[model samples]
Target chain A: MSILIDRNSKVLVQGITGRQGGFHARLMMEYGTNVVGGVTPGKGGEWFDGKPVFDTMRAAVKTKYADVSLVTVPARFAADAIMEAADAGIKLVICLTEHIPVADMMRVLAFCRQRGTRLIGPNCPGVMTPGEAKVGIIPAMVALPGDVGVVSKSGTLTYEVGFAMKNRGIGNSTIVGIGGDPVIGTTFVDILEMFENDPDTKKVALLGEIGGSAEIAAADYIKTSMTKPVAAFIAGRSAPPGKRMGHAGAIVDGGEGSADEKIQALEAAGARVAANPEEIPDLLS
Target chain B: MKLHEYQSKALFQEYGIPIPQGRVAETSREAGAIAAELGGTVVVKAQVHVGGRGKAGGVKVARDAAAAERHAQAILGMNIKGLTVEKVLIDEAADIQQEIYLAITNDRSAGQPLLMTSMQGGMDIEELNRTRPDAIIREHIDPILGLQPYQMTYIASAMRLPRAHWRSFLKILSGLYACYNKSDAELAEINPLVITGAGALLAVDGKVIIDDNALYRQPALTAQRDSSDEPESERLAREAGITYIKLEGQIGCMVNGAGLAMTTMDMTKLYGEAHGIGPANFLDIGGGATPEQVATALSIILSDANVKAVLFNIFGGITRCDEVARGILTAYNAVQPEVPMVIRLQGTNAAEGKKIISEAQLPHLISAETLTEAAQRAVAAVQESA
Candidate 1:
């Protein structure tokens, strides 16, 4: 069994009428995800890809009984969409929209915590369980079904690592992009717990970048909690200090978030740290 | 997204936080005039985004108007940490009885906004937290409940603030919170929240870093952006809806996603360092960018003369590979780039993209099957060209 999602999990696509939402919703269905329903505020009663669209998440979940939701709304309305999904009882929500205001994310995060609903990303590529279900925007061709579970903060980096693993005949159990925003829904520790519990997952590969204490926290968790062998890659090792490396969260600030510091912490915690993506397969082996 | 000290103070003043009367001046004569209006005893502080302006000699106390002119003249044209000082804030000097530190910033680990206050003020808070952690008091604010009065009082008492200054301090705290929330600021800080000899609490220095994500909704705050401090390419990239950061190297990278772009840069650096070449710049065309946007990104990369070879790493998710290929061809024809290029396309419609590239068979272009191969080829190409 894969972590977070599987073959039987029904998914709801929030903001399904929008360009990105519609496109990815179709892709998810093509990848064997159980696309159950769609939700749009003003476009109710419309059918997208044989799924009924509802104006509100409550009505859609009530009729379709979805267990998970893919939020594809714009950044301005993403927080409300997430809160609606949580209130409608979707246990797991994956947000694909990026650039969500930090304050809006703080409120939504607190709300999701109170309701015990798991949120993946507000600026992420989403999650995928290979050979079962795919949610969010990760290209399905890059990932193959296997025993290694992957978690990362960057979307393309996940693809790069997954492609490398695939080239080495190392398929993945599940892959999660927790997003590269300063404030994200899920942490490395959260995904690590799931990977450790999944019996199909024999090992994990965590792809991290220079920012935040999430990797350090994950290292601490791996040191104390897990028995699975983990190989990790931290990007932006040579990035200049005080410069943002594309991602909003990928910045070295106050000497706190740096590749050297993250590498040191991960190494001390018994995790093999790969210097480059090409080395991840060997480290895991 | 970082506002100048003067801009931060303007927002603070709007929120009822007391600030020393200040005027921004682009000229030394204007600074002297402002200092004369403020009774001749003024502080000439350079306006730049980088920290440690005081250490950089960007800040000075002018005892008279003539001194103010000299100080402004010296600080205005100076470069502090690669950012040139274009303007200076001339403000009335305060008679400080004591200094305090107060700021509101996001605590990413807690997924909440943290309000931090310290008795030790006018110093680097990070340094203070490192050396004297006990001197700071932190309170996590509930986004819904906000900064409660009791929470403010608790922090004030924890910092051992005098009872006489508690009310005004609370007002400043609330005002700062309002500014942070209303402005969509990632950080709203008053480094030295000073208590004057007249027993008045004032925000002596202020800093506000607005969240770039929220800039779309904040038109007024976005208008405060000083693009002069950024590189010309960065400013142009922002206008073109791409993310670009110029670096010191020979291989220019154009990638689809931020994470992938950084990884590409890292890989380029790793392989290029061995070959005595490194990534020249960081450019992300972002998700679902059009062919024209890709063309624009390529032009930006080529605009830098230091680049000897261009590396294109595209993993199509929302970004279609064929579109990126078309954009590359468009840029190749338009810019007539003399430098060599190594391209790697994968995922959505990658075969179609590869067919497009092979069909064109542009001169000096090398196609690779993977990121590692592409980086290696680009590094080798740059070294060969050099």
Candidate 2:
């Protein structure tokens, strides 16, 4: 009853030869994710943890069908990586790379949108359908299959919220990390709409920080499109004005992008606000 | 990664856009010598990372070399919004026939570069965009083919640039876009892209923000960065491989996780409002930072003169709270800021962790029962400081 994935979904690892790709692939495989095949440019007929490796994604697609593709390549090459996966008939693509140039992401998003591919993050933590497919870098030690659907832009906080939820015997249907890149492929509204439509997901835990109109846009969606209980925790209430860290889009400008401003907007939309990370689990419950 | 006007103009010139003849001077003597060499009325602008300098007494019109020297002396050592200036940009004053604004940046919603243009320039364009939305001409450019001739023409027409001047406008736009792509700029802006009385379309003021990630590839640009423009603490953090952003609040934040950092700040405000306290800054030492790094992170937060109290929220998984506590103690020994600190230790080894902090016998440091209590304690401490 997970949102983006379930037990039947098979996953493919792109750029599997790289360090981050290899590391996360093993983690997903260890977590019992149905990691079907690995793709590298020239390293074919190789074996990583008893899985077949192919030179190109096309070859990998022909031999093994992957419902989701995790793109772990560098920023400059992320666009081509996603396009290759989409052309090969992969339905979902989770971009794990950070600092993907904004312009490159636009072209990739355009290419994927035409093909009807669901892109999770160009800077996001990949999706995790708990107790099923853990395709992202979320600490699976804390996740359990439950009714709460947690989505966040911050990586480590996602783990914390998941830990808090698990601590309270509240498992999660799925958790999505919408990376904090300014020009990410997916937004809060997109995931909220997805979580809203998933009947297994009884509640949505939204984690946002100071930056952009994403929070505002999410509030607009919740007010109109979504019909589920959304418990949101807007972080960076004490964010320094007009400074950006890690994420390019994650900056405050002209005092407009503050955590309080976001929380107020979310509260106006009828969502319960978790003032602290610990309060998130109880709010979701 | 904001570029000063003079630096931005350097990039604009590389893109073939025309700019007022200018040189950057660090000393009043240099300012006078450069102004005298240019032999005209000059604009002396304080070189700081912040905006609103024009109103902050950071920018001034100098009638001649002597005035330029006087203005430079006033600006170079002046403090604009906590950023002390060390350089002044001396430029030939423009004739300004017509002024317009143009900029390009990432629009997260459209997942593309948003080209913003307006006929209204030299002031807060936000006001105009809010009041008269139609006044701001915007287009989402396709990244693959880059900016097209037709799109530039559309913007040129929207700004009501004389039909005879469309060619120059098109050239500037192309160069700007090229500069944006080639230079790996996150933002390339020419506010008041002026048309001189001599009928020349020029980028009088330029701002190019190079993407920090791309700095490895752009060595020439990497060298051009003025670290003096950044806050002393921010530069120190950069050198330490920590991402620290200074904020104006009362409660100082020190958290191990970026996500936890945000939640700590959010909760502090929630609790602060409940108890009439506010946060002074947001600090994320990052998960897996050594105890020493944790202590260093604390010192940075305490370095802010505005901070009244410190909030430590460490979620132990990849980061152990006991290690973070040790860092706090180590940092306390090093910086020794006479401020209150409240820490909530959770995840791996939570109890053994709380005992460690208590055993340290540190003054003004409180051990909390939970994250809520910790945030409340921090806010109360800050309010007490007030």
Candidate 3:
């Protein structure tokens, strides 16, 4: 019932010998993700957390038949790692690395698109199918299995919104962190389309922040197609103009990508917009 | 990461694109010397990161060295949109026959770099795009294939550029694309790609904004970063690996993650709006931040005298609550913050974190389980103190 991934998905961890990869690999495994193997270029033929380690994604996929990949490589090698995963026939790849060069991402995104492979993020928290499987860095305890599907452009905000939903006794079927980079792999429309088709997702929560027209475009999609009740929250309502609020993409440029613009767009699209995270549950209801 | 006009022109020159000879000068005397060397008429333009320098009288054409010095004196040390003009670019003026615009920027919706051109240039492109959208012709360049010659021809023809200027336009366009690609620039713009009276095409004004993430590979560009352009607290936060932005409010906020920090600000604003109070600052400790970094963030928040209360909202995933709690305690001892504090610790050893805060027995420190309650309490504390 989960979109993109579930407990049955065989996952391979790329750059598994690295600190971030190693830490998140264990966490994903602890959350019942089917992490079959890991790939660390020179550290092949080794074992990490009782899983096989290979030198390349080709070798890992051959041995474990991984359907998905969790890429935690450093920024410099993230694009290569993603392309390698996509080239190795991995249907889905989630990159958690941040600060990746934009040109590299452009190439990697093109490569993945050519192969019909879905890539999640290069600076994102990854995805979680609550109670089924977890990928990336979202804390496992914050999520629960339910009918609401959540998607956000931020990691911690995803956790905050999920926690808020959990507090209201509402859980999520799947939650996707699409990253906050200016040039990211997935868009709000892409995740919204996936959520709309998932049978278990009775309602959806779309969390966005300042910057980019993704929220506006998502509103258009929701207005035209989405039948599920969607509650939306846009952050940075009080943010000053022209200041980059931490995220590379979260900047107000040329009077575009402001919080007010996004809120108005989403509200006009018929989705209830929450003033804060606490109001998300009621808005969805 | 936005390069000044002189920097962008330097890159443009390196890529073999023609630009009016220019040199950056810090002092008005140096500007006059450069202007005298260039001879004839010269333009003294202020070097700042913001736009609308022309409207702010940051750009002026001087007919002689003395006039150039006067312009530099007027433009330099002048504050344009809150940014002080520390340097000015003195360049030999050109005889403009016509103006055209050329730029390369990422089109996020298309997921590719877009090369936009307009026959109407030398003015506000935003206003042009808004008023006459059809005047600007845009073509998305595949990052892998790059800016092909055919694509350039397509755009040039679409703009109905004269046959005589096509060759030079294509060369400049290619060079501009090269500058954008080689420099790792998110945006490379040549407003007023002027066709001179002497039948030469030159980039009159250039702008290149390097991708901050790609700066690691661009050592030269990274070195050109103007720290003076940023606020003191923002600079300190960057050094400490925290994300901080100053605001005009009474309640300071420190949270984990950019999204959460902004949400915390929004919540504070929502509850505090009625009380005529809001968050004083936006500070994100970032994921996996150390205790010392947290302490540094606290000190920075407390440094703001207008802050009547501080709110700490931590949802520990990679950031451990206990580590943050320890950092808070350390900062409390060091900064001796007089303002009332509301701390909400959740996720990852939150119980231990709460125990640490409670055991500290600081009268000003208050703990909450939810963001709503924490924001409400922080606003109420600020109101009561006021």
Candidate 4:
């Protein structure tokens, strides 16, 4: 029981002709994702990598019965793309694009909340269930089906945690990157709720970074709703103030979003904090 | 992007918020002329993207044109902390009978926009919150509803505003929110939203920081950036389309994996500061970084003036170790860096990749056993360079 995706989920690729979409589609197919079709307007009736192309999501979903869509369109068109996906009745959507305008996500998130569309990311590495289904850009080969369900905002850190889990022979049920954007579609709390209910997931390793109060909010949620054992690592412990580490949401404004504050909040909420990357493996045990 | 008071006030004016008449002047002569044109006393304040300017000798209240000119001369030419005082804002002085503060910023902890107002102003809000929490009022604004008129009215009335100034305060409060939303700001603050003795609400000082991710949509805000204040290496890295963050580590890191790159830095620190190398930088070439991109990342890492040794810690999954080895060899041939290098390649094609790197036989290129070994070798190389 992967939290969000499994082998039976049929997937459609938005902007299937784009470079990023084409590249990751091949990887997903190789990883055995049930990639049913591709969608790019004006490119209907064409094919790429053995997948049929349709002009609209509604047409592709109607013909192939696609239940999932991987969105790779630009930020300006992402909201419309999501709405189209919702109208087509795709239950799960993964947004692989980065730097989506917050206003666009604002409308998209509000719509998804009302319409019951589950979003995995807008700037994330996607979700993967080992030996089952994969969506997004996560390296499928490194993952294995196991008890730990991983979720993170940082891709590199997710890779680190996954590699550590692998080194310890502790497999992962699902690893979903909620993304590093301020207005991310999925939160740790959302994914934590899913993981808590999943029989396959006995534990969760959450990797967060400096910036934003998502960690603190997640802490509050974890205090009550979480049932699985949770281990977390918040990077940027020694990272200087004021400079954005990289992502737009990584700004250390007014000392509120510093790693120290996040660590304190998480510790208070009963999370075992991995102070650094090397310490993460120890926390997992 | 942080705008000075004058710029933010200009933005405030556009949103119909009432601000005192002000002009930014670069020189004392311009300041004197502006003060003279204003007909009387004016306040001269330095323009910097930081707070505590009043305590830092950057703000002065002058009685007349001569006093305003002197204060402007003192502020314009002086340096506050590390930032140069290049401009002074000249504005008509307000008779501040009461100082109230207001701001709107994303409170990540609350997972929404936060609206903070205080009867206590012109002081450290944090200290005030700790010492006298009741002096301030905080509200978590719903992202969907925003700060509605009724909420603003409630806060304004609770602050005990005079009946004469209530309408104006309401207008200014709405306008502030408009400015906050219009700029896509992460932070918008007015420290001294004063009620003048003459009973007029005045926004004396204000600041706004537009979100960097929203920069593509905010061309004016992006263009207002001062590149001079940025690190040279960081600027060059940005131009090259590489994600590089300068650090204090002695071992300069050029890695294909961002996660491994960070772990490399952490493990390097674990080995101790024998060479006092702060994290030289955080470079993420992203997944599927090509040999050319790898080579470019190498060149950028080597280009840092403080870098004495360069460490390549790559864990191949999607990024094949052989391709990363090829990149190192290519960058080595191109840049011909004289400093030492430690290469830690694992995962795909590790054996073949070792053979390829060893074949190059570059003088400074050293292969290590583990991340620990690589960090030690890099630190030793830095000492040798020193």
Candidate 5:
């Protein structure tokens, strides 16, 4: 079975009445995600997409039995929303809101950890288990049901790799976007562990960008713990030092985090590092 | 968002961390007046975001007011690591007995705020860490628990700080941590936290990088943003809601998504390697971008004179290809860029987007179905033009 989300997962959409929340919630529903209800603080007792709206996550969780939550609140309130979701007993918290303060996220992670909740992404595309459920912003068209589990720190790049894999007639078991934030809820090793345990997943594709030692840690983990064959592609190889390449986390600092270092680490760990995004599927095959 | 030394010192003062008495000066005459006010013996430090200001001669010690003016005059317009020194901080020079390093930064791996201190101060911490790792003492502060008093004491004792200075050192540590926490700073550093000849602990140099994500709440710090040190194009891109970074190559790239934008830049560089051409800039139009934003992004790319050719790689998910096409057409009509352009539109409504561009039949516009083809074409066009 696919990891994280499946057809049976009851999802609650936080900030479901907002523009981004409403837009992506509809897309998630269209892809057959088991979205039970919506949560908007003041807009409670309203209805969105024929689902009941609640003021608090506790009400949403209690009334609708929502096991998972997709937080689409604005950056200012995102950390609080995540903490609320965890405190309200949502097992899997998926935050789509980006740019929450680093300190706020650190506290949120601590809060979530104490509550035994698994949080994924504050700036991530969310997760998609092909042919089962769609939880976040990952497009439904690009994914096909199969065995290659995909995890990335990027959105469109994951879509590109997924589309290539789909074209190569190799579908995905699950796709998790852990986000490219300097501080995120989850890490590469966290998702890789799930992919390894999932029987439906035979191989994994990891899409990484420059910045952070997570890739190096992942490489170490892959070398020691992972048994499944993993193919990886890292972006920002051509990026210059000390420049942030769009993503907040994608920056080279003191020559620590570079694509070359990551690629070398992954290669040394027995993982095939693809030259580009399109070569990912070929590497996996 | 990196705050200049003077700015960081101002913030440090607010938090009760002692800094050398100083005032920012834009003119050499102002610097002279400030130095005279501070009893003539002053340090003129250039205000710029880049590091190694000391090595660049952006920092100078003046024995008198006249020397302060000369130093400020030499520094104000001087280029330090590609950044111009527009202002200098004139401060009363400190009599250093010893130097210490202290900082509070986010430890991404631990998911906590990391407090680092070293006796080997006034030097590159990274270089020090690489060379003598044990010389640096680190403490992880729980976001909820914060920097405990014991943690600070442990660090002070570990560094063999004198018992007499421990009390003041602890205050400085707590003050710095408080400033870091309250300001939502990614990094709050006091490099060379000097013990003065008078036995007073003072923050001789300060650096604070406010978390950009938290800037919404920090209106004061946001107002202090010095655009002079950064490229004008970057500032424009930020205002336009585009994430842009200027490069030294010729192929300008506009793509949706940060990862894809970087990859597009890499691919462009890879293909252009043989031709000695590469991406001139990294521009991410971002997801769900409107036509106006896309047009603005295009304008920013075109604004870079080094750009010989422009590449548009849009893999539409939340960002629709049709919207991108409309924006392209809008920019094409508005800017009338003379550079050859290549467009690759895939994912949602790719065909519709391609059809829209082809139907427009804009002059010097080319299309590719794949990223590889688009990069190849973009590089080839730049090479051909060169």
Candidate 6:
């Protein structure tokens, strides 16, 4: 009943020959993701982890019948790989590569939108439907199958909160890392709608950071549309304005995108906002 | 990645956008020479990154070359909003008939590039948006189709700009968009696009902030980065592939991810409230960080004299916990840190990581099982030291 993915999903690994792509591909496969094939432009007609490799996504898609793609190509080539996946008729593409140029992402989002393909991230840990299938870089150890849906902008915090919650006997239906880039393919509101409709998701945990009005928009959506109980945590309370705190999108610019603004908004929306990630499990409970 | 006025103007000129004839000078003599060459009353504007330079007296109009030199002397080396003015732009002053604000930037909410303009210029756009919302006109450009001729005309007409000036206005607006797109800029702005006494449009001031991610492709713009504008520690952190921002607290923080690092800071602040202390710095070693980078991050944090304790919160995903523990030991040997330290390692080989730290037997090192415990311990260490 997990949203976005399950054990039945057929996944293709783009840039499967690269270091990160290769490593995470094995992890995803080990976690029971139906990774059918791999794609590397020049190194086609090869085999990686017992899966067939092809030169182009179009060829791989035709042969493998993969509906999903995990793009772990280098930052410079990631956008092109995403467009390639969309062009090949992949319904969903998750890009875990970080530091992609925002301009490239703007074009990629437009291209994907035109093709009706849902792109997840350019600088994010990918999605995980725990105990069913996992994509991207979320560690298998932390993911446990249950009813709470988790979405976050940060990869490690997602792991931290999910791991802690799992230890407290609260497992997750799905965990989505939408990335911490100024321009991302999916937004918190987008995932919130899906989580609300999923019958398996009884509650949701949102992890947001400083930057963008995504949290504010999420709060608006939560107040008006979401019926599920939601607990949230907004990071970077101590961050100063105009400083990029690690993530390119995690900057408090011109007095906007502060943690206080986001926390206040979420609390006003009837969702409990945690002062720390450690408090989120109790709030969700 | 914010370009100075002179740099933005240079880029504007390259894109066929008209800019006042000007050059940047580091010395007053050079400024006077540029002023004289322009052959009219000139304005000496201090080149610094912060806004409100006009209010700070960083801007002055000189009626003559000598006056320009004097103004340059006063403006140069002056401090504006914590940034030192090292250069000045000497340009011919325009006879303004009207001021218009225009800019092109990414609209994250709309997921498109936005063009915002106002007839009321020489004021902050946010202020204008608040005080006179109707005065601002905006259009979202499709990233694929880009800024079309019709959209340009629509905006110009909406502004009620005279038909006589539409052609020039369209050129400048489209040129600015082209610069914005080609440069991969997050923002390209011409504040107070003036209608001169001659009935010609001129860009009085310009600003461009290139996306930091896109800087890899923009080598020329990357070279234009002003290193003097940042602190030495920040510069070192950037070079080490770590994200570090200095703060005025006592606990030095090193975490794996940006969100976790920020959360760690928040946690320290929340718990440190009792001890009257907080995180002294925000440092993310980034995913897949090597022991060398961790050691480097530690050195950078320890270098901050304000730091009384250090907190390491590493949740291993792509980043391994054992490697970080080894890095901590390596840094401990190198820096001989006297301040107490709290380390929390979880997920992805947490057992091996804990074993490494225990075997290192480093002095002043404490272990915590959870983020809450780590933050409390870090603050307690700071309090004990104090």
Tens-digit lDDT track for model 1 on B208-246? Answer: 999998998899999988889888888899889899999
Residue-level lDDT of model 5, residues A127-156, one tens digit each, is: 999998999999998889999999999999
Q: Report the Cα lDDT for residue B171, model 2.
A: 91
Superposition error at B213 for model 5 (Å): 1.1
Q: In candidate 2, what are the lDDT values of residues A94-170, reduced to their tens digit?
A: 98887776666777888888888988887777788888878877766667898888888988788778888888899
Off by over 4 Å in 2: A15-23, A40-43, A73-80, B248-252, B272-280, B298-310, B318-342, B348-366, B379-386
Return the lDDT, model 2, position B285: 80
Tell me the deviation in Å of residue B325 in model 4: 2.3
Task: State the interface C-alpha RMSD of candidate 4.
Answer: 3.0
The 10-residue segment with the lowest total lDDT in model 3 chain A: A276-285
Q: How much DockQ does model 5 earn?
A: 0.82
Runs with alpha carbons beyond 4 Å of true place in candidate 4: A220-227, A264-270, A275-279, B109-112, B124-147, B158-160, B256-264, B273-275, B290-300, B347-351, B369-373, B383-386
Chain A TM-score for candidate 3 is: 0.98
- Give the best candidate by DockQ: 6
The clash numbers for all candidates, in the given order, read: 0, 7, 0, 11, 0, 0
Per-prediction DockQ: 0.74, 0.55, 0.76, 0.38, 0.82, 0.83
**Model 5 lDDT per residue over B1-386, tens place:** 99999999999999998999989999999999999988858999998899898999999999999999999999999998888889999989999999998999998888999999998888878988988789999889999989888898899999889999998999999999999999999999999999999999989899999989999999999999888767889998888777898999999999888999999999998888877888899888888777778778888888888999999999988777887888889878887889999999999888899999999988889999888899999988987897
lDDT of 6 by residue, B158-220 (tens): 989889899999999889999999999999999989999899998899999999988988999
Error of 1 at B73 (Å): 1.5
Model 6 chain B weakest lDDT span, ten residues long: B316-325
Cα deviation of A143 in candidate 5 (Å)?
A: 0.9
Instruction: For residues A8-39, write the lDDT of model 1, one tens digit per residue.
Output: 99999998999889999999999999999899
TM-score for each of the candidates: 0.98, 0.90, 0.98, 0.92, 0.98, 0.98
